[model samples]
Target: MGTKIKISMTAISIIIGFMLAIQFQTVKKPKLRDTRDIWQLREDLLKEQDLQSKLIEEIRSNEDRFDKYETKMKDSKEQALKDTLKELKKDAGQTKVTGSGIVLKIAPFEEAVLLNKRVPEVSPILLNRLVNELNMYGAKQIAIDGERIINTTVIRDINGETKINGRSINSYPFEIKVIAENIKAANKLYNRIQVSPVIDELFVDNLKAIISKPKESIEIPAYDSSIIIQYMEPVK
Candidate 1:
């Protein structure tokens, strides 16, 4: 009776161990890793790879866009050159000059003109006439007391003070540089002028009228002030 009871107990212990081992291997092992957790790991890996590819493609596209922008910028700069030239032409206007040259220097008016006595000061009409006659004789650039004339301008003696191109004139010896067709003709042409006795008598430091062909460059600075050509505007 004692041996039978001992054998039954041993059989029950072995069966219990076998059943627990089978549960760990077949049911508990698969249930421990949930379906949601496995699916999340797969999605994370795919997202990481796709993000890397998108970053690389974005870098390449930005480089191409930058190159195209640089080319457009270059073309814009070249196109701006034409506008610059047109501006230069309008500012300087046009000059008609031929062959060689002559230079006339004007000294200060006599004390009567400067003192504002009963005598009239130098007027705009006289200066304009002189300029017109010089242009007719083919002067290139006309300068009054070192100020260059671009647009049609006036020089006037205001009371005792003098002004040229709407600004005050400072120093003495007004000058005119002519591009002469006939060098000898300048001497003959100037003699014909019916000028004031006081004007004809006035003398510059370098008094003689000079007619010489310019071999070197003659520099005349453009007018410092801007001129609006109201006559040349388009109708509104």
Candidate 2:
């Protein structure tokens, strides 16, 4: 009976030893694999952080370059616009200009008016004809009675008196200033106007048209009237 009891105790001890070995192996394998996994995860995390830092620096650099480029473009555009405005002002007669040209004087013949018993006021038709001839002869800028003639200028007979831009002009004698493109053009304009039929027509009306020879320099004042556009649009 004692031998049987001893054999049973040995069997129990062997079974307990086997079970402890299996549990220990299972826990140790998992711990080793977890250590490797943790190290790999840390390496990956560090690499990702480095990439993120590089991307941030690149973004900052791009923003700085963009700011500089934008400023340069803005400055360039502003300068271009300023130049265009200056040219436009000159062409629109918003500024004074000087060039070689001729001056024309119109006056009523005092003796003829008394003899013919007719008023010697210059007619709008006669004035318009003279202006058109001057333009044809290369007259660049023209002014009558200190009023600048622009594209928007209007001349009409308002209430028995010849008016320009809604203002009455002098009756007997008035001056017309003209600016030509060049000295040659001014001479041609003067010669052509001196012998034009317009002068003959004026003479028939008991008025005298006298033109001066080409001057070295003539100054034309800027247009003083407002330029208002009522109904005009540009096509695309």
Candidate 3:
């Protein structure tokens, strides 16, 4: 009986030891692994955030440089063209006149939905094309909601939304102000606004077109040097 008791005690000790080892591995090992994995994840997230911040900064700097460069380039090109025009006017015995003109305020209607979308819609391209026509008609200065139209300025859609000059502009009531030397000529030239079917249809509602003759002195800045001249020594 004593030997049998000793054997039972030894078996119980072995079972307890085996259970303790399993408990340690099941509970402690996973907790250690989880801690390691969480630390790695946090580090990775921080790295991503840092990269994003750097990229944003770089983009902003590049944009600033590009803006200056584009403005300068546009000025140079416009100046060269103006000089050529002046020479032509001299030959033709015509003088370029500067006079008070009209300011046209144009904006898209605020209404986004219709009874049904079965009909077509007005797009930004239509507005852009109209602006191009105005420039072609010799508009002295033109601005859309305070964003100046320059040679390098491009009207683009950003992120499936309306935007101009890198800023998000709503499609509601766009204000286009132009200062020209001749209002009659400008109006007569732009009478074909109906050519842009989208603009004519969409802006037909709540779209107020006003031509104001503001005699404000508009000083059109001169253009910069757009071309470079190179001189070579004669048979050096």
Candidate 4:
């Protein structure tokens, strides 16, 4: 009976020692609690709001850049098409041009008139030759009697009369305006025509080709007639 009492007392002492150890650990390391005041919490909230606002602004900036890029692409395509159409019209002689060039006045030769020789008509062959020579010497545009000479221009005699673009060239002392690419080009054309044998050839036909000095600005009217398109169609 004494031994049983001694064992119960030892068990009670062990239980007390375990309970004291748990209490000592609880005092050494207590749970942490938030000590921040309401003001500090409000400052943190404002910082978060500012970050969110910055993020929204960045997104809007990116959207604006994308929109501008798309608009520029569309505008560039439209501008390219406009430029191409303008170039086509210029090539077709449908637009009036002004540049440096020279002029030619054709009339009866003075010597032929003095000699009382019958003044022959301006032959189509001589006119064609003169035009070919002028084209070879960098003549960009040519207008004979106010008719613009294009790629489809025909100079043929009909009924013993010379007609240009269905208009009669029966009168003398008419003007033939020629436009060059630039002032230097006009000067070059003038020098070439001065030395060309075509001038003498015109004299032989009793026609005088009086060339003028290169001028700074010479105007050439556009082709006034309709251009008949043959064997060509627009793409679908």
Candidate 5:
């Protein structure tokens, strides 16, 4: 029993010594602390804050750029739509046109007037033939006696009088305005009309067709009547 008691006391002493050594080591090595001065610490904090501010500014700048880009895209789309509408209106002959073109003056032939014979009225067939020939020669637009000629124009004989677009051709020496694509086209049209057999055909009917030289600018009136649409519906 005495020997067992002595062995238990020795074990307790060894455990106590191990705990004291661990405590002594902990005391000898103090915890590390920041040793930078207050000014240095403040400068570091300011640097971090400046960096954060720059990042925020960059984000804001990017957002602004994106907004501008979106606005530009929207504006471009609207402009394209406007341009398309304008072109459609022009093509439909709803707008007045000005371009390089020529003028044709129609009057009674000199020979017919001197022969003491009443000048014959202009024939619808002859006029229609003339219009078709002009179109074949690249006439973009045409107007006769202050009336715009569109795709729907009708020239016919109504009660012994030649009528165009339902309006009577009341007198002689009327003007027919013809517009071409450009100055070069206008010149080509002039050259072709000068030698066209249509001129001789007009002379056969006791009428003279005097074609003017190509002009740099000619104005054609727009179609004034309301257009009647057929077999067409708006896209949903």
Candidate 6:
């Protein structure tokens, strides 16, 4: 019985040792399989470093291209916005405009018979009619007494005096600068004003208005006033 017990204990010890050895081999086999020689490890490290460097270079190259693309798009959008703003400024009469046009100068007719009669001052109705006529004949810009005629400009008879842009134009020999679309437009406007019944009526009223031929260039001042947008909004 003692010998059998010792033999059983020895058998148990042998079995435990065998199992431990198998586990040790199982764990160490993977390590041995994964191990590399010294030269091979160095070569693999260099290869990984080269691959990392190449990836970094590729990333930098793509970033540079993206930066250039972004810059180009930004420039293009900025230029487009600038162009739109310039056109808006022009259309709003915020910038001085120069073009080929004509000038209409009006004065009281000098005559002995009309001297005793009250000299007819230019009426607001007459000025309005003249403006409408010029616009009908392709006049692009119109100014009287250095006041630009815009969409919001007001011309009326204020306090028995002709007022343009809320300022009285009570002087004789007043000049009206008209900037037309082109030389031909200027000529057309001039010819229309010369032949219109408004001129005849003015003549009967002892007011003389003379239209000059188309000039090579005529400059119109900008509308120097605050523009208030009361009832406007973007469509989108």
Name the weakest run of 10 consecutive residues (lDDT summed) in model 6. 112-121
Candidate 5 lDDT by residue in tens digits, 107-153: 98777889966777788998898897787677889999988888889
Sort by TM-score, top down from the best: 4, 5, 6, 2, 1, 3
Positional deviation of 230 in candidate 5, in angstroms? 0.7
Q: For this target, which candidate reaches the highest TM-score against the unseen true structure?
A: 4
- Expressed as tens digits, the lDDT of each residue in 1-236 for candidate 2 is 99999999999999999999999999878754445577679866854775676568659966875675567567797765666567567767778889999998888788886787575578888888888778766688999988888877888898888888888885668899999879998988888778767889987888887788899899989988787776988789
Off by over 4 Å in 5: 1-79
Task: Flag clash pairs in model 2.
Answer: none
Candidate achieving higher TM-score, 2 or 4? 4
TM-score of each: 0.41, 0.63, 0.38, 0.66, 0.65, 0.64
What tens-digit string does per-residue lDDT give for candidate 3 at 142-226?
6666565555455777776555556565654456666554656555435533343434544554454544545444332222213
lDDT of 4 by residue, 59-127 (tens): 996687567656766879676566656766877899999999999999997788899998866888888
lDDT per residue, candidate 6, 1-36, as tens digits? Answer: 999999999999999999999999988785546678
Number of the top-ranking candidate, with lDDT as the measure: 5
Candidate 6's error at 26, in angstroms?
A: 99
Sliding window of 10 residues with minimal summed lDDT for model 3:
220-229
Q: lDDT for model 1, please.
A: 0.55
Report RMSD (Å) for each prediction in the order shown.
35.9, 35.4, 20.1, 34.6, 33.9, 33.3
Cα shift from native, residue 129, model 3 (Å): 0.9
The positional error of residue 60 in candidate 1, measured at the CA in angstroms, is 57
